[model samples]
Target: MAFEQSLRRPVAATIRMIVPAGGAKPAPPVGPALGQYRLNLMTFCKDFNARTQHIKPETPMSVLLTAYKDNTFDFIVKSPSVTWYLKKAAGIQAGSGKPGHETVATLSVKHIYEIAKIKQTDPNCQTMPLESICKSIISTARTMGIKVLKELD
Candidate 1:
């Protein structure tokens, strides 16, 4: 009701700031460790070259669901917020849009999260990633008023 609407508003605003959802960068940081990779640097490097560097370039950046052929989300949100939400769901910071280069491209939530970020962290990171981190973020996004674009089941 009114309470839910009030909550979603702020989340959407915060999302808009996290990532702008513009076109791919000329040299987007590829792989997990363009800056830092928790797992393997070589794997990231291999993944980077294969995923990025093939774009037509010079295209406007925006979250456009219609542009892709395999899009199947119930709600299509073309914004930086959606990107932010997905990264948050996966328990990592955003990477480059190009898969091998910086990121693995836009993917659905069910496809990304095996566990929360904290659980994936080193034992010394001081916090165990809780299973609910993803759910909590979803709840927050709901309050902020962005169409979740997924079924909670």
Candidate 2:
């Protein structure tokens, strides 16, 4: 709590104006530039575990990864995270497998709101109000001349 609130350090900021995409060449990043994006990704990983540590131990382990080109989310697990949520957040449900064969699942996000809502319950997520996070990241990436090939929608 003290770390979250009381600790304060200088957050340097600089403004760089650039034409929007499909216009003139983009401007270079300002401030710490790409560091913020990396930090955010790392933060998301850490926060997810901390917030769910108690429930997660009893819950099964799973690996979550994304396919960048396809804009799809994938998970591989002997036991699914969904089953853990069903048991922990909802009323009791039957445990399907003490140890099941590893399975991988992938899904596309045709509707972004659906994913945003799902993100709320993500154990590894620290980002609430994803809209702003998305905007900042996209803007930063654009300014840095990084391509975003996938659409969340």
Candidate 3:
């Protein structure tokens, strides 16, 4: 079984994107990205929307699509990004232009822990310890000019 699995051809391409749940369309970015792989854009859009229908329509999701040589494809949907959570928690619309030198907003360590817990649910993050995830989130928050505080008021 292992040998047979190894003999199988590698996937032809992988496309990664942050798409809104239930909001895919045959548009420029989606169409061109999938078109290059010779995959049916509509099929992917419909399937993706259907699978994510339970989530809120405007929620942003990370999707990883793997296209096989035989034209079949598979995908995995992940939770929203850490930066998105940070922005929402800090009540900021966007990051500061001068991240290292300027501070845009502040969030609590409680917020960091909550976001880290959420991120741990992602397949790629399942093996990471909560502390590591929180540290990563803290670094990302700093890059976005958001301070992670011991407590928030």
Candidate 4:
């Protein structure tokens, strides 16, 4: 079984990249990286764009790609980073420079829960409990100087 598996799909490279949602193009970053491996850039771009069409354009998507020796590839698209979600929820352009000392924005518990729910859809977070995901998001908010409030008062 192991021999058959290896022979069927021998991996040539593993690539990690952050591409904009629905914005895959055969250009500089995407082009050079996959072109070197002789993978069909147009196929990847079309598939990736179609998959991310539901997401807001320009949202950064984390992708893990496996290029096989036969010039074929497979990839997984992860949800956007927690920080991006937090910033969007808070309507902030960036995090506070001083973090603890400087308060940038406030988020209600509901907001945290919503973000957690969205994050739960990620493959890595699928196995984790919802409460654990909420806790991590809350921690991230604190580091970004965003206060978590019980209500939006």
Candidate 5:
């Protein structure tokens, strides 16, 4: 037991990035980001691509990587951002430039609730209450110039 415990190394650093689904490559961002840590870039690219294969190609995915002292690393892939989901549900390409002054799209409260449910599945949000998650989603929608309505009229 002691020998096994000794083999475990503490996390040396954490890196976060938004990578396109199934689009990991040993170039530019991925290369530079992990290169400094002396991580095996090709291995990361291959593993990331394989793990994200089920998602649609080109969909943006958020990933968190933990590098240990011995150069070994682990990572977790999170679902897309709330902003992305909002745009999809509202059928908009982008948020309004003047969020408060102009509205780009309107979303129903039901939509907000649904998004909250999706977000709640994320590890970071698992401990948060559903009502709080819904509120946060509403706030994000507001900032994106998406008016949240009680019902579609």
Candidate 6:
């Protein structure tokens, strides 16, 4: 029991935040949240920015950070949200206020497939079938007043 306990580090806190890709700085949300836990702000900002450099700048990336009692931390960065992707693919600035009652834009099955493929790369979604992901995306599109067509006209 003693050996096992030694191997496990007590968790200080679990922090969740949405930060722009490659835009993490030791300021505002990031600084305040991590600073409260006495975690290294500059280290986190540098590592996060490096990891998300491949993604488009200013795209919101969801972060799950685990701060340990020893003032150390680990974080996982997730891709942009489904709504962001949907809006970009539809070339719209925002979803329709009325959703089902009003259609703001249309997307093709191919677009759904592509988005599903991207979402599959997420650690949580890796085990979900591609078809399942596509269906979920379609459902979200419906709620956002986006139409999914068999093919583009």
Output the number of the TM-score-best candidate. Answer: 6
RMSD of candidate 2 to the truth, in angstroms, is 20.4
Q: Candidate 2: misplaced stretches above 4 Å?
A: 1-56, 64-80, 95-118, 121-153
What is the C-alpha local distance difference test score of candidate 5?
0.92
Candidate 4 has an lDDT of 0.96
Model 4 Cα lDDT, one tens digit per residue, 3-84: 8876778899999889999999999679988999999999999999999999999999999999998999999999999999
lDDT (tens digit, per residue) of candidate 3 on 56-141: 88789998989888777889999999998899899999999999899999999999999999999999999999999999999999
Q: Each model's TM-score?
A: 0.22, 0.19, 0.88, 0.93, 0.89, 0.96
In every candidate, how many clashes are there? Answer: 21, 2, 0, 0, 0, 0
lDDT of 1 by residue, 1-153 (tens): 998876542211111111122322323332221223122334333332343335333322232111112221111222223345455554555444344344333334453243235223423222634545556544543443323444434
Ten contiguous residues with the weakest lDDT in model 2: 18-27
Off by over 4 Å in 5: 1-8
Error of 5 at 47 (Å): 1.9
Report RMSD for candidate 4: 1.5
The digit string of per-residue lDDT tens for model 2 on 1-109 reads 8786554433333222211122211123211332432323333334434544544353444433332222222222222333333333223344323222321221222
Ranking by TM-score: 6, 4, 5, 3, 1, 2
Give model 5's clash tally. Answer: 0
Per-residue lDDT tens digits for candidate 6, residues 1-153, read 999999999999999999999999999789999999999999999999999999889999999999999999999998888999999999999999998899999999999999999999988999999999999999999999999999999
Candidate 5 clashes between residue pairs 3 or more apart in a chain or in different chains: none
Q: Which 10-residue span in candidate 4 carries the lowest summed lDDT?
A: 2-11
Ranking 4 against 6 by TM-score, winner: 6
